[model samples]
Target: MLQALTILSLLFLTDFTMAASEDPAELGAGLQNPGYEELPAWFKTSFLDLTEDVAEAAAEDKRVLLYFYQDGCPYCAKLLRDNFTDREIVELTRQGFDVIAINLWGDREVTGLDGKTTTEKKLATLLGVQFTPTLLFLDEAGKVVLRLNGYLPPHRFAAALRYVAERHERTGERFSEFYVRTNPREAEGDLHQEAGFLAPPLRLGDNRRKSPRPLVVMLEQPVCRECDELHQDVLRREAVALSLAAFDAAIVDVFSREPLQTPDGRETTGRDWAAELGIEYTPSLVFYDTQGREVFRTEGYLKAFHVQGALDYVATGAYRWQPSFQRYLSARREALAERGIQIDIMR
Candidate 1:
């Protein structure tokens, strides 16, 4: 029954996507006009001073949602029309946080948390706002607690609000963990197949070809929405598709009983191994170094930019130098921008 509902949902969404129009205004039942900069009145009217905004939100006992969007971005429209327009979501936002919209390409002055003034575009660049509809949930101290890089459907978006509103991160559980442990959404996309992915009978311990790259074990399940998003948006990117060649990637169904040699050379069923590893989410990428030692892993729904960054991080061996993945990605984005290369971050 769950699977059937998931498939129906997918079909519904597919039809909606296929019926898009060239004119942005005509796209969402004429709910949006392209180039219009108006935002929800509930969104705080700030002096564009992030420090003050954060302080005010803190005083009100609320988190701050920094929404970075552009005028014509379809994902932004979905977020605005499909998600934000929902009365329940609006009320939830009002209760939990003070939402602020920042135009990614606007010239409006913004005083950042560092007490420095910059244009909205410059501030977005500084904060790595590579994708429209990026939502940064900030703590009282102005530190980013959670970052949503793309448009999430209503359920997942609501889950994110609850996660941050309830301060789940303070419990030392990752958002993916919290999400899975709480209200799991119905599946969105099916498990994606790629030619580069290793075929079944996956003996991950054996590298007879002596490949110098690391091993990436993708633990996923069929009809996983997060998994679908990864294949649809992230893995198809030229950079990520190319970067994947640097690693020996394998996918294992978390619920399957298929036997395989683990990275530590232990023979176990996929289900058993996933249980041992506590892989609570589909589309989780567990990176293992050349010697089969666990290096890094991302266990949640991530946008193309973040997913690609993970690939680059493991392939280029940057994880060894930078303790913070976010910091490394910032430096990487800055370097690419300085090189005059355009980044389609949400691709």
Candidate 2:
């Protein structure tokens, strides 16, 4: 009897240990931490001081490029492997900018351009870095001349490099103008119309005040493959479709002259408004509150999970309380985990 009782106790202890050993991240959204990538040797090694770095780069007749990334990020890995590996791109980047990498969830001390000290993670939060591999191209004054929210394909990435490196910003030409002029590509057909999107003559000024729903203006171009992919694939997902039900979406061709009233009650054409907003990337989704205030925006290639998260982030009014979209996503993963729902972000 004593021997049998000891064996039962051992079995219970083993089961408890096994349960405790399970990864907590798996219980939530399947946010896999892709292992770290070895940064290029030519990448600038710094003490993470933004002011000094900007000054030093300016002294060399170069700009500052802030690369925000996280461990195990596939897109980040792609940017390094695809864009950085190109000889022309590497040479242009090395000659024109001082690149500094900041981990999205790192603990290293960072002295910001504002001369305030913070952790790398906090600095990311302050900059509102919602996605991995968000790159900020800064002018000599440390102003973000251009900000790429997500990964851009090689052609567009190279165009962006030239736009800044060639001092197009000083010429008063928008990056969008430079990109379209320099790197025109044959894209798929017209805007993919959805039943959920509000038909044109979009008086967003009226819609915001009258309806309780938020506004999502999709700034796209006729010649954009990414826009085509977004409409054909990402929008067709069930989760993304469900989230669209919560907002009044408007699809506007960034180059079109369609007359529309802006959210701030200004009468303008779609093209003018898009230029005014600095909508550089095609298929940029700009979200606005019922009060006509801009809430959140996403301007690069994104999968279904992230698209849905962006929709839900503004739709649920979560942006009011949670300033950091990354933190909000973390909380969302935790909440979904509690309900036994696992999400694959890359899916």
Q: Count the backbone clashes (under 3 Å) in each candidate.
A: 1, 1
Estimate every model's Cα lDDT from 0 to 1: 0.79, 0.83
**Candidate 1 TM-score over all chains jointly:** 0.47
Assess every candidate by TM-score.
0.47, 0.49
Best by TM-score: 2
lDDT of 1 by residue, 138-184 (tens): 99999999999999976788888888989988989899988888875
Q: Candidate 2: what lDDT?
A: 0.83
* Pairs with steric clashes in candidate 2: 34-72
Per-residue lDDT of model 2, residues 78-148, tens digit only? 68755675445677899999999887867788999999999888999999998989999999999999999
